[model samples]
Target chain A: MSFINVLSREINCKIVYYGPGLCGKTTNLQYIYNKTNPDAKGKMISLATETERTLFFDFLPLALGEIRGFKTRFHLYTVPGQVFYDASRKLILKGVDGVVFVADSQIARTEANLESLENLRTNLAEQGYSLDKLPYVIQYNKRDMPSVAPVEELRELLNPNKVPDFEGVASTGVGVFETLKAVAKLVLTEVKRQAG
Target chain B: MATEPKRVFGSLEELMTNPQMVMYEEEFNQIQAIVVRLVKEANARVVFVIDKNGQEIAKAGETDQLDTTSLASLTAGNIAATGGMAKLLRENEFTTQFHEGERANIHIQIVGNRVILVVIFDSKTSLGLVRLRVKKASEELNSIFEALLRKVQDPNRETPFAEITDDDIDNLFND
Candidate 1:
């Protein structure tokens, strides 16, 4: 859901980054935070354990260029990826406008990816949302890893929807904006459709 | 009002563009004047009027540079979550809350029975003054908003989004 301001002619949407543990979910946000123009973003807040994995979520708000007359803002968040933090993940998914499923491309983490995806479907169902129906996308992350699964195989298994999937090395910001833009676009389009 | 459940708009745009578009220049000015007066009367450094969904409509003092959007959204989320908690506990609603920190204190009150009024202040303002001022402002705001709703429900009002084309929306996706 979005918070709309008629005075400012703006809409704010929440987009969540979700995936399994150590899947670069937090890293994606950090990279974007580091590279974003200072004027375009607010302080990035990370609720993390001592080990640096997200505890609840990581929040970063980005201002994309305006659409029509309204300034489009997206609040990006990453859920704690560990299985034990399932409760926190469900809490973060509340009121989400769109989702970016960041998958660890490493071959060793294939089962982890599948498990996380299943968890996502289940949690979304609990909240009365469906992954297939929502504006959802997949990001095959950590492409730099030599042990990562091939893009084709990852697509076949994870992105059957063909929603704008990206091959990303988030730490270096290769496909970070691409992924962000894809989700932001989907969210804004959804807003327009809802308005009409 | 009837006991029928309040509708939940699935998205921000939907809520803003609902057939019940409730705003006009006169009410807008009235709201701004009331906010300015309320801030001064309350002796507060800042005062903001956030929509029921937590979108900042207008603010007075110390708010020009702040990202009110994020704050408004979070406030809305907090209120919704709190309201849900109240229902779970079989209560009516969570009316208000106060948070006092070392350097600053915040008074968050629900106004117009729909919006939230947030006053951020320091030692410059007293709690008594803030409460008295907010009480007065809330009543005035409540009436103005009720009239604004009637204006919104008028059959002659035009929609802002009626002119937008699908291609324009698609262009937003062209990265």
Candidate 2:
């Protein structure tokens, strides 16, 4: 869900980067936070353990271009990728206007990718949001890594819904903005439809 | 200076016309007082109230620099979504949610009839004090909101949105 504030002429939406452990979910947000103009972004918050594994979640708020005089702000978040963090993942998906399901493309992590997608469905349903109905996209991250699953195979396995999927090397910033823009576009389109 | 009344009217007129809305004035005053004290006593930077739909009802303290309405709306959505999950999974109500950052932290609690109160602060305040202060404020707010909801539903309710025709809504689309 998005909150459109008529008083301040701004719209705020939440977008979550979800994937299995070590699938580059946090890296995706970190890269964007680093690349975005300082004025357009807020402080990036990461709740992680001493080993650098995500403890709870990561958050970054970015201001996209204004529309109809309202500042379009997207609160980007990443859920802990570990399977044990199911509760935390569910919490992060709450009120998600759009989702960027970052699937690990490594051949060895294929099962993890499938499990994470299923997990996404279970979590989204628990939040009363249907994965099929909501504005959602998929990202094949860590494509640059060796032993990666083929993009075609990954798509066939994960994105049966075929929602605008991208191949990204999040650490190097490849396809990062594309992923963000695709989700942002879908979200804004939802707003237009709602208002109309 | 002259903007105060207009600003209030602009934000407050949504549900203000009902004959049963008599408590609105008192409730608004009370909420304002509680928020002011929370900010001062808790050493908070910002405090605000967001309706179930995420609209900003009233806000005080360090709100001018940021977009309260958007924050309120998004935060409300977050609470509502999580609240919905709690209901679906047969869990108890989610009382509060907090997000701690390097420089700032937000403390949010669900109040009467699905409304949310959010306080944003930094290292200046302790979470224990903020939580206690918010708990007290939430109880007081719950009653006021309950009364306000009754007023909203009191058969004698008048809706300004009702006066807005389909054409008006369509015109919003055009612009």
Residue-wise C-alpha lDDT for candidate 1, range A52-153, written one tens digit per residue: 878767778888766688677788888899999886687677667899999999999999999999999998876656787667888999999989889999
TM-score of 1: 0.77
Worst 10-residue lDDT window for candidate 2 chain B reads: B1-10
Compared with the true structure, what per-residue lDDT tens digits does model 1 show for residues B1-175?
A: 3332123445654343333233455677889999898778888888888765444666898887776766765676567567667777999778787889988888888875577888888898888888888888888888887777666556465444435666776677675
Question: Best candidate, lDDT-wise?
Answer: 1
On residues B1-175, what C-alpha lDDT tens digit does candidate 2 reach at each position?
2211111111233324211112245567777888888888888999887665444566788987886645764585577567767878898668789999999999998885456889999998989999988988889888777776675556554332222344332333342
My TM-score estimates for the predictions, one after another, are 0.77, 0.68
Badly placed stretches (over 4 Å) of model 2 are: B1-46, B50-59, B62-91, B94-109, B118-175
How high is the lDDT of residue B173 in model 1? 64
DockQ for model 2 equals 0.08
CA lDDT of B82 in candidate 1? 73
